[model samples]
Target chain A: QQQVKQSPQSLIVQKGGISIINCAYENTAFDYFPWYQQFPGKGPALLIAIRPDVSEKKEGRFTISFNKSAKQFSLHIMDSQPGDSATYFCAASMEASYDKVIFGPGTSLSVIP
Target chain B: DAGITQSPRHKVTETGTPVTLRCHQTENHRYMYWYRQDPGHGLRLIHYSYGVKDTDKGEVSDGYSVSRSKTEDFLLTLESATSSQTSVYFCAISRVTRGEQYFGPGTRLTVT
Candidate 1:
């Protein structure tokens, strides 16, 4: 079973537009949610993370809006740029374990210039 | 990015052969993980080590085996390679308490 489910296997957005990707989970035990970005031929890098206590977290043009009760979360990249084109993955983890993280399938986002 | 390196960044082998991939960490983190990334699937954990000589299997460990003799190195081995095992493998290290795992560049393995 996919503990965390992500939608829109692929997406395309023009530059300066708002790009959105959504994710939902079935495990309420997950307390930490993180988004990772990966480029071709490279490993994934941490983009942003949010805790259950906060409804939304933003860093620069990237934002993560989390809904604890809904067991859902979404990633928003504002003013999207071509450089932002990459595969984005959403992951969930609970502190109860010693850092065991479960990742979502991933969303391929393409930002047009 | 943490100081993590995956040896033999790329490898190709025939079916029924044995292949081993190594993950080394300079960060000296207590926890290390081995994961596989495929085209349509997210990264799936093959195995993980909490400390030297202490390891555990992850969700997908059927065709793989792992070992950690020291805190700095973790190894994943495929007893008998198969075409289905061809994929990109990644290693990550982290401090258990922090829950922030750092990943390595990754290794591309092909089993023909």
Candidate 2:
């Protein structure tokens, strides 16, 4: 079973437009939600993360909106640029000792300049 | 960004041959994980270790094995490599007090 599901396997957006990627989780026990960005031939790096207690988190051009009741979370990139093009993965981890994170299939986003 | 490294960045082996990939971290993180990435499929966890000599299997641990004898080293071994096992493998390390993990450059393994 896929613990986390992501939609829109691929997406393209104008340079100045907003790029959105959505994810949903089945395990309600998950408290930490994080989004990772990975470029070709590179390992994934943490972009933004949010706790269930907060509804939204914004770090510069990246934003993460969380919904506890809906068990859903989405990533929004403002004023997308070609540099922002990469594969994004959404992950969930419960507040436990191990904190084993389960990741989504991932969404490939491209920003055309 | 952490000091994580995977040795033998690229390797090719024949079917039925044993292959081992090494992951080394300089930060001495307590938590280390091994995952395999393939086309269409996202990263799938193979194994993870919470502490030296403490390890557990993950979703795709059937044909893989891991060992962590020290805090900074983890090894993933394929008893008998198969063509289906060809993929990019990543190693990640995270400290107990840290929320985010740091991944190594990755190892590209191919079995023909």
Candidate 3:
């Protein structure tokens, strides 16, 4: 069973446009939600993260909007650039499980100039 | 870069053969993890260690074994290679269980 589910297996956006990817989790025990970005032939890197306590968190052009009650979270990239093209993964983990994260399949994003 | 390195970045072996991958870290982190990434499957944890000589199985641990005898090194071994085990393996380190995890470049393994 995929505990975490992500929408839009892939996405394409134009430069200067907004790019969004959504994710949802079935386990209410999840407390920490994080997003990772990966470039070709490299490992995934931490992009942004949020906790259930906060409804939203923003850093630079990346923002994570989380809804605890809905068990959903979304990532928004403002003014998407061609350089932003990469794969994004959303993950969830609870403190009790030693922070063993469960990740969504992934969303491949492409920003065209 | 968290000072993590994965040896044998690429490997190819035949079925029934044994394969081992190495992950080394200089960050002195207390936690280390091994994960496998595949298309449409995201990343699945194979094993993790919280301290030297302490390890735990992850969601997908079948046919896999791990060891952490030293703080700077963690190893993942495939008892007997199988085609189903082919995938990109990644090692991650964190200062604490809930802290941010830093990932190594990755090792692409192929079992024929």
Candidate 4:
């Protein structure tokens, strides 16, 4: 069984547009949610994260809107740029065992210049 | 890459052969993990070590084994390789169990 599920295996957006990706989880034990950005031939890097305590978290043009009650979360990229084109993964982990993160399939985003 | 290096970034081995992938860290972190990345599967944890001589299995540990003799090194070995095991492997490090982790570039293994 997949602990976390992500939608829209791929997406395309024009420059200066808003790009959205969604994720849902079945495990309530997960308290930490993180998004990672990966480029070809490189390891994934942490993009943004959020906790259940807050409904929304933003950093620069990237934002994570979390809905604890709905067991869902989504990533938003405002003013999307070509550099933001990459594979994004949504992950969840229990606070006690954070290293054992459960990841969603992934979303491949392409931002047109 | 969080001072982490994985040896034999790309390797091709015949079935029934044994293969070992090494993950070394200079960050001296307390946690090291071995994971496999496959298409449509995202990443699945194979094993993790909390400290030297301390380790535990993750979600997918059936065909793999791990060893952490020193704080800086974590090794994953496949006693008998199989085509089903062909995938990209990644090593990650974290200072604490619930903290953020840094991943290595990855090792692409092909079993023919």
Where model 4 places Cα greater than 4 Å from the true spot, the runs are B97-99
Alpha carbon lDDT at B73, candidate 3:
99
Work out how many backbone clashes candidate 4 has.
Answer: 0
lDDT of 2 by residue, A46-100 (tens): 8889999999999999999998898899999999999999999998876584636
Interface RMSD of each: 1.6, 2.0, 1.6, 1.8
* Model 1: CA > 4 A from native: B96-99
Using lDDT as the measure, what is the rank order of every candidate, best first?
A: 3, 4, 1, 2
Candidate 3 chain A lowest-lDDT run of ten: A92-101
**Chain A of model 1, TM-score against the native?**
0.96
User: By DockQ, who's the top model here?
Assistant: 3
lDDT of 2: 0.88
User: Per-residue lDDT for A1-113 in model 3, tens only?
Assistant: 33899988999999999999999998887878889999999999999999999999999999999998989999999999999999999998876775468999999999999
lDDT of each: 0.90, 0.88, 0.92, 0.90
DockQ, per model, reads: 0.64, 0.57, 0.67, 0.62
TM-score of predicted model 4? Answer: 0.97
Q: What lDDT score is found at residue A109 in candidate 4?
A: 96
State the displacement of the C-alpha of residue B91, model 1, in Å, after optimal TM-score superposition. 0.5
lDDT of 2 at A2: 39
TM-score against native, each model: 0.97, 0.96, 0.97, 0.97
In candidate 1, how many clashes are counted? 0
Q: Which ten residues in a row have the lowest lDDT in candidate 2 chain B?
A: B93-102
